[model samples]
Target: MDKATVVRKVILFSALAATVYVSIGTSDEAPVQVKIPTSETIQRPAVSVPGTMQVAEELGAESDGSDPFEPRNWVPAPPPPEPVKEVVAPPPIAPLTIPEGPPALPFQFMGRLKDGTDEVVYLGRGDQPVVARAGEVLESTYKVISITPTQIEFEHLPTKQRQVLSMQSN
Candidate 1:
């Protein structure tokens, strides 16, 4: 035979021989015999461990239908404390008089302006600014005596006390 025909016949023979070997090797054998014990044949010890028995009793495992894992048997924790009330403090009391010296002036000198021939000075007491010329009375107590570019003079009407405020430069 030629070389190619001889190689094909050898490969076909090898495949057939491998198939037969695997089939025989995998054939079923006799089933194994297993013995199962009956309740009458199986035996348990007459006594259990003392500690295990005590634990089981405490967990209610021996009761007729009680289950230790049930939520109904557990006690709920107390409700959270009531929310605290906010405390409000009272307003402070004002003093009757100054302990020493004259009372402080609330006016702040802003700037000066010239209206006609008379000079006008602006003073801030709180939020509103006051416009004053020479001899203008303010708050029924402070009398404007003179107005200058750098300063303005005032006299307390009741006590005749003179006070001067200089312009604040910015």
Candidate 2:
């Protein structure tokens, strides 16, 4: 509708018409030919470079006389570094000493009796009644060390470990 829009449409139509005319136009001349040489037609340079021959000779001299393509001539890759052996120290040895002690006294303190010079103590094991006195070994396993009103002390004969039993009423 505007003058600028009309002018732009006319220019676009002219460009499209020119492109179509050129695409459909008949040409009198033939298409130009381009030649790409094959491997047999390719030519190498006539002149040899100065340092190339010396470089080739040096490369040949440094070889170990083994074929480059031979699998047997290739060096094995150093056995993969021997897998980096980790030295693990053994666990610390515990000190060797006596580890066993006397087992728990199976007696329950029943009561005590003041038997003139030596005080006697009554101990019960399970349902059996046992009587003990000071310095007397009972059952060949325990020695009655001392007896008190509230507690009694006994020594295990095997280990010489002293243990006390309290005389408490339940």
Candidate 3:
């Protein structure tokens, strides 16, 4: 064999011999003794047999007429109550309609005068005196429809709604 292999083998055998020699030299002392317990010799905790027997008797009294071990005598639980459905009201079918009309007249009647064949009415707008004849449009929003001695008729230019102004004598 090679020199290195012989050296390795010699080292391995010397380590094994040393281990065996140490194990044998250490056996000169007495062996340690350990006691193992058995189930028969072990002490068991005490229980109250009267209380357990009384509980078992009460359970037996509360049992139903069906036998627990018999599968045919078992009763299936009733199905859970159906979930409550929320009622929701529908939206309105048609929207509400708002009445359409013109605003109130802002003029006050003062008096009337004869303007040749056509008559002219005097009206008061705040502190201003407005003279208007039949078929004339005043303030670009109101058109004079007719003029009379006691009352005057006017039409709202934008909404085409008729309005009247009465004469007030003091």
Candidate 4:
């Protein structure tokens, strides 16, 4: 009807509904000595196996039950190595009789050819001309063109024709 009387009625109705709801929510009876979670002592098993309830005894595990990471129980180890051997070598040797020098320039020193048939050194000092080997000096093939005896003039060695040797310049 009037604005002041309407506002007073709405306030009284809201207060009565609030009291009823709070009383109904707390009406269930719990015991006087109730347990809260933090104040209780929990029960736990001291030793634990990984997957099952029983202990791990099948693989020779000792049940002193210390830290699982410690290596107090492991398999045995192997033995040590053997020593090496040393080698022994042989001694050196000596030779037989001592060897001689190269044979004397492979030549017999034959004397002059036209001196009234004188000795040929290759013919063992006999009558005829003898054949010459490669490095040997022949008397006829090499000539003293003029002789003063201090140094005889020479046209020396290796004649294809007996007159035409002229191997040396001087």
Residue 65 lDDT, candidate 3, scale 0-100: 49
Clashing pairs in 4: none
Per-residue lDDT of candidate 3, residues 4-68 (tens digit):
99999999999999999898767878876887889987877554665544545555654454444
Clashes of each: 0, 0, 0, 0
Model 2 CA deviation exceeding 4 Å by range: 1-99
What TM-score does candidate 1 reach? Answer: 0.39
Residue 41 error, candidate 2, Å: 99
> Which candidate would rank higher by TM-score, 1 or 2?
2
State how far residue 48 of model 3 sits from its true place (Å): 81
lDDT of each: 0.77, 0.81, 0.82, 0.45
Candidate 1: RMSD to truth: 13.7
User: What is the overall TM-score of model 2 with all chains considered together?
Assistant: 0.40
Model with the higher TM-score, candidate 3 or 4? 3
- Per-residue lDDT of 49-165 in model 2, one digit per residue for the tens? 645445445556555555444466366656555667899999999998866988989999888778578777788999999998888998999998877778889999999899998
Write one digit per residue (lDDT tens) for candidate 4, span 31-111. Answer: 368776563576555764563213545445765656555566466655666666676666766668754432222222343
TM-score of 3: 0.40
Best by lDDT: 3
TM of each candidate vs. truth: 0.39, 0.40, 0.40, 0.16
Task: List candidate 4 stretches off by more than 4 Å.
Answer: 28-170
Sort by lDDT, best first: 3, 2, 1, 4
